[model samples]
Target: MTDVIIVGAGPVGLLLAGDLAQTGVDVTLLERRDGAISNLSRAFGVHARSLEQLDARGLADPLLPTGSAVGRLRLFQTVEVDLGALPSRFPYLLITPQYNVERLLLERARAAGVAIVHNAEVNGVDQDADGVTVHTTGGSHRAAYVVGTDGHRSAVRQALGLPFPGRSVLKSIMLADVKVAEEPAELLAVNGVGDAFAFMAPFGDGYYRIFAWDRDNPVPDDQPLELDELRQVVTRALGSDYGMHDPRWLSRFHSDERQAPEYRVGRVFLAGDAAHVHSPAGGQGMNTGLQDAANLSWKLAAVLRGAPDALLDTYQAERHPVGRSVLRSSGAIIRAAMIESAVGQALRGFAVRRALSVPKIRARITGQLSGIGYTYPAHRGEHALVGTRAADVALAGGERLYEALRDRRFVLIGDADLPGWEDRVRVAAPAEAGGPLILVRPDGYVGWAGRDGTGLPEALTRLAGAPSAHMAGHTAS
Candidate 1:
């Protein structure tokens, strides 16, 4: 028996396993594949907020070298959003392959002692009042909680009898990762003419990932794609092929927008693609899933360490709404890109231009797209600062807020006389004086804030788990 059984060793599961194991929870990660990461780069754009989460874990700086950062992201067909003004250390999008992320997270999880079982495809899950049991091809493993990060066809979600209710949005989308001889004028290139739409972006490595669609020619996903045919579609959409050749990966895929009714079912939880899926328009699919893992991992660790069971309920309360929002936003992007008529195209560019002209609307759109504008729901009469994203602030002794959060402990950002919560809460004074005493969650959000340390002990106890007695070995000194 373990404290947690996490199905799927993809990026989401790897991140969750790493966090739980870091917090001293006994975690087991199950993977369907034989532990080899494919070279395909499906989800490449990591937004600012996700970078902040990675920054808090001390992984952000290390990941910078593996990918390129782009300040401007073109969603589809000339509509682009500028990510420059987003208030984050990582104000730009990091264009790295999903496998690079998984590799880093998997290494961290293993180093933190997470027991990973490769080729242990989960077939069934049973959860009762006491705990949950996951039956796999290898054997049965029981745990206090189980999370399914196993993508769209989640065995755990199916076993729990949950409904993933959504419809197919786009069909016959051509996807490939190849080399482009000539770099496009824009950092990211996307254009749509009539029905033919093509999108391309750098891997930051030698290869480039391109998504092209020949709307007039609809075929089955299994239909073999010829390089010449793709080049013609690209030329139709953007007027130049940019010397595209040497394909490493190519396929035809359909995009579906799906969201599970409930992210949690008893002791079994669902996250990532297992819980929701969206069109690949804004590159929000993988970013949203990574955030889901971040939001839930801390809560699960808190619950396992004797926090109230109610805390687990917040995973659904907070993340389900975000999932729905991504569906709408990404769907809008795709639908706009697929506009068939010239009049429709004119209206799309006009509406998008006008909407983006308003400062308030522009900020909101940028925030949503970059994941910087999201906030959790706060309790009634709570401080306005509560549940807002906490940007990295300078702490005493030349450290930053995210650096303090690297320990996975609540950062009490003001003087506090808490005796028993030493292991779970890290007290730091702001580098400058007279700042509010803000309690930052390990996930980089403000849990509580006040002029002084009033209501902080209760906040720490409730959010970071009841006071632990020892200097826990799991924490990094």
Candidate 2:
């Protein structure tokens, strides 16, 4: 039996597996596909928050060369969110293929000794008080906990008898990755006219990803898609296809907004598309899933090491609400883009421009889009910074906050020492004097902060398992 069994080896699963492995957790990744990572990518945009998560793992700098960054993201040609204003080291979206991310995480997982079982299709899961038994096409495996990072039709979720609750948002959406004869003026172009919509983004290579939708022509997923149809739809919706041609890939699928009623069912957990999915309008789908993995990984690691079991429940409390928020925001964007009448389209453009002109409204929109502004729920009377994302503050060693977090240990930046928690926590002084005492979580969120060290021990108990001498975990300086 392993400590954790992760079903699916997509970016979400790979990241979770790598994280668990890094902290000395025995992680087994069960992938249905053969022992090969696909080059194709369904997600092309990596938001700023995801880049921060990668930064914590020391992968962000290495990933920069693999993709390009765009400071501005245009939506429907009428609305745009300038990512330059985001308060992050990675203030803009990275336009890399999803495979690039998976490749990096997979390497980390392997280096950390995560056991990967290829061609293992998990068909059932049986969890009791002790552990979870996952039944796969190859065989059955046991683990203390199970995580399903599978796509929308998650077998683990299905075995749990969980219902994905939501409705279809769009139909006959055509996807194509090809080389465009004419480049768009902006980094990204998306617009709708009348009953059709088309969005295009570069893959950093010669190829580009396109999504063209026809409101009147609904078709089945198996329906044959032609390059001519894709070109014509783009031309109708975008005024010009930018001379799109030489299709490298082409397909058609509908978009849906779905959220599982339960993110956790007993010892099994669902994340990524398994927990929630939504309209592709905002490009938030992959970003939200990566965030889910980041939140759950640390919690599971702590719980496995004897932290309070109730801590796991916070996964749902924190991420489920975020999932619902993404759905609402993405749904609103897609609905506005699908405005059928000319007057409605004009109003949508004008309203979005007007709303974004206001500072508060613009901040909220960009924050939601970039994912850097999200924070977990802080307890009553807790410090204001408790649940907020930890900024990359400078430390005495000429290192940054995220640089310290790369050790997979909590960095306590303040005037206190974690006596019995040296192995799992680190004490560092901020480069600047008079800084507030704060404990930054491994995932780069503030776990605890106070004027003094009065509640430090209690917080450590909650942060990691009861601190023991020289625990089996990584420690920063």
Instruction: Write model 1 residue lDDT over 1-477, tens digit each, in one string.
Output: 899999998889998999999989999999989989876758887888888888888788888898888897664455667788888888898888888888888889999999989999888998888999999999999999999999999999999999999998767889998898899987768777768888887877788888998888989899988888899999998889999999988899888999999999999999999999989877898899989999999999898888888989989988999999999998888788888888989888888978888889989998999898998899998789998989899999999999999888889888776776777788898898787888888888899998765576567667876666642322211
Off by over 4 Å in 1: 75-78, 469-477
User: How close to the true structure is residue 474 of candidate 1, measured as C-alpha lDDT?
Assistant: 26
**Whole-model lDDT values for every prediction:** 0.86, 0.88
The digit string of per-residue lDDT tens for model 2 on 230-329 reads 9888888878878877888889888999999899988999999999999887789989999999999999999988789888998998899999999999
Each candidate: RMSD = 3.2, 2.5
* Candidate 2 residue-wise lDDT at 139: 97
What TM-score does candidate 1 get on C-alpha atoms? 0.96
Give TM-scores for every candidate, taking all chains together and pairing residue i with residue i. Answer: 0.96, 0.97
Error of 2 at 453 (Å): 0.6
